[model samples]
Target: MQCTDHTVSLDTWKNIQSLGIQCKRTTYRGVRAGWRKQVKKHTNASPPGNVSLNPPSPSVNLGVINAQSVGSKSAILVDSILDHKFDLVAITETWLKPDDSTADFTPDGYTFTHIPRVSKRGGGHVTEPTHYLGRMLDLVISREGESILAHTKVKERFSDHFVLACKLNMNRPPTLKKIITTRHLKAINITDFCSDFCSSAFSTNLSEITDMSHLVDQYNKSLTDIFNMHAPAKTRTVIIRPFSPWYNDEIREAKHKRRQLEKKWRRSKLEIDRQLYSEQRHFVIGLMCNAKINFYSALINESANDQKQMFKTFDKLLHRSKDSPLPKSSSDEALANRFSDYFIKKIKTIRDLFPPTVTSTCIDVSTNICLDHFTLTTEDEVRKIIMNSPSKSCSLDPVPTWIVKEGIDIFLPALTHLINTSLQSGSVPAVLKEAHVRPLLKKSGLDQDDLKNYRPVSNLPWISKLIERVVSARISDFQERNQLQECYQSAYKKRHSVETALLRVQSDILSALNSGDICALIF
Candidate 1:
């Protein structure tokens, strides 16, 4: 409990339990002498020292041991760790080298960072002038009473000097092992490695392949192999229905009892059993309500660190989306097919307004646009266009834009040739037309039950986008040269605007008036 101005009287303290309040009596300490939201009358700032709400611990036991050679006396070091259990241990004169393997000497759950001797460097010093007193960064923010306990001692030792060991019981790291399953293509960022590998892979593997399909297949496979070798895929856990705070033994039992009672009621033809079942159902509902109340109340009274947990719980309660199960399908493939069929139908319906007959109207061609008269796309242009494409998920080709961009320089020659071939052929590749679609919820409520409430977002490959851009540029150039489109159309044409149209109309109207001729409609 916190009181701003008034002191807590005897009655106030006694009735505190009824008010459902928790408190810590310690006064907050800050640089401004004491904690103040806004200091009205300024006072001198307090010196930075041990002026804190949390008292410093005097039981910290940190020690150091220099055993001269750790490889010979590793057993002794383990015994020392077990006996003393020191908070921190620092040892000097570790005679370890860069090429030395430490795989066998790794601790069970502890992490270690080491500094190798200075004799192995080819370049005088890579980063800093100082010696290798190796360290990590300010990754995690330390809270009150928080500390890191490092157990650096390993059984299979190799150094002459004893390894530095640190231990802390209060602030141990998390032990939960999270499994992650990913292709690792998205995670790895080795542009040089990718470029070199791709350059060699595509050149050697794709040199003799005559079939275009076979060439692309081998090229993709080689790239995939190189990537897999460098940065392998990961097997991770994906949580579908994660654990909930409100669900517990009491709630579980209550739910089970309700289910049992429901079954009994359905089975019995007598009115007495039905009446008893109704009573049980009401009792179970009350039990669930109480459990929920207790759960939220406990969360509300928790420390500030658990605010996120509380918010997640609140969100879970608000939505209750997990309770509503999806419709049953034969398999995952069946479900995908079902959704594809439904959305395709919807799309066809939407597109039916303009029939084939309407679309086949004759196009006026006063000036001939020579079908083969096209400028060959340059290497730089192709590179720029591909790079300009957004880094999105891969399509049927499974070629990510980022990966393509990373090794763009190496693959530019091949890409330029491909684009040239496409232009000369006057046909886009079938792969470019292929797309992957994902269905997303449009919005919540009012129309949630209908198929129309969902929208499909189609993701196309970078190759498709590149082709479209090329074709669009040529079309626009042709349109401008032939004056095919109306000059008054300000929407798509270059250097045209609403103001330009208005000015042209004004000029026509003034000319009509001066010539004593009627302008029926100036526009």
Candidate 2:
């Protein structure tokens, strides 16, 4: 049969089969690194190592590309991908309408591919579709030490949308396969391989494009178009889910229920299907969260070198966001502070699971000394505490600033205590002036003028300056109450300490009395 862009002669069909076998072998038992690394050793030349390389042995990474229709947003999304060096990027709704005036795709340094959409016929003039009738998908891939080898289109089911796929030539041919159907196998005089993959029952929970037939038709049509053209001898077809709605609420809930049932049947048939295996064809299962970065290794497995690297990578990815709304009160300020707290927690969790080796120079920031001064008792203790802190779940935004504001109240005391104990800088004024403090004020919806009435200490000259802004009248009363409460708390703590000390002194006096007074009375 003729395939897309080329005739699938017997030789071609054999080639596809061989490629598929090679892929299975490579994925299951290939060398630790990649095909290029072996080539490099043979060539006797080595370049700087790319840290992003997933040392071979069945690991897949998943990332999302939020490229907006506008060129500016697309550039930002592309930059983010390049910076992170993600393994796979599931791009969403790329409004790429190809026409004479526009290029079909743009790959940059990456090899690009897309599934072109076939225009659907309208029933009448009134039924005509606007803009474009067909859906297309674009996939771009780049491999270290490889030229942009394969950039082309294949018709594939991505979701409801078409999927475009690109794979850098890792010295392996792309293999597209079709499951032999019962009818087809009978007609072709074949048997064993026709075992029903659909009724496997083991595959029921797995998500796929709801309409598999439509996807297959798209693939066949694209194959025809590709075969009609004279292109590379190696080009083959693949079926990639156009997109996955795993993040959708309904799907997630359903999966959660399934997971619960699976847990109950752990010792039975479910265990076999649920066990982590390289054979799982799903991208997330097959690649992204692999053995190298398993859940167990991420949490407790921390060595100094690995911990350092994990933090470094995390810090780089934590790019500064645009300015948030200004907070008007201390409550608002606390909410702003929660953003970093939450982000840092996420970093810690991921790092705990997969402790990547990190390095640091002696001349790095001198902030380690400050960790002890905060509410954090010790720099080391702060790791798990801040990482698992409750503030991690709060979202910082102007519209729902209250959520962040509320979380800050819960987190700030813990954070403040940690900072106070570990990194004791008497410069409370300076600390409050930092970016973290500013965001809190903006979110609190309280004005500086409102804070003036709460001054418990007139001696601190900076207190007056903070109260000058009249943004929120409510803050004045709240701050006043807070000051009074703090004063009472301070007094109560001092009183308790003094009473305890006095009691100890009195006990010592009683001991002395026992040693002397009885002898005197007897005398």
TM per model?
0.42, 0.18
lDDT of 2 by residue, 406-489 (tens): 343333332333234223332333322323222223333356343322212112222112222211222334445445334423
Stretches > 4 Å off in candidate 1: 1-180, 183-192, 195-201, 205-215, 239-332, 347-365, 395-399, 443-446, 486-523
Cα error of candidate 2 at position 407, Å: 38
Q: On a 0 to 1 TM-score scale, where does candidate 1 land against the true structure?
A: 0.42
Q: Rate the local accuracy (lDDT) of all candidates.
A: 0.51, 0.33
State the lDDT of candidate 1 residue by residue for 292-375, as single tens digits: 568777766673466766676665445334222223567868866777888989879889976666565687767555656567
Query: Candidate 2 at 52: error in angstroms?
Result: 34
State the weakest 10-residue window (summed lDDT) of model 1.
123-132
Best by lDDT: 1
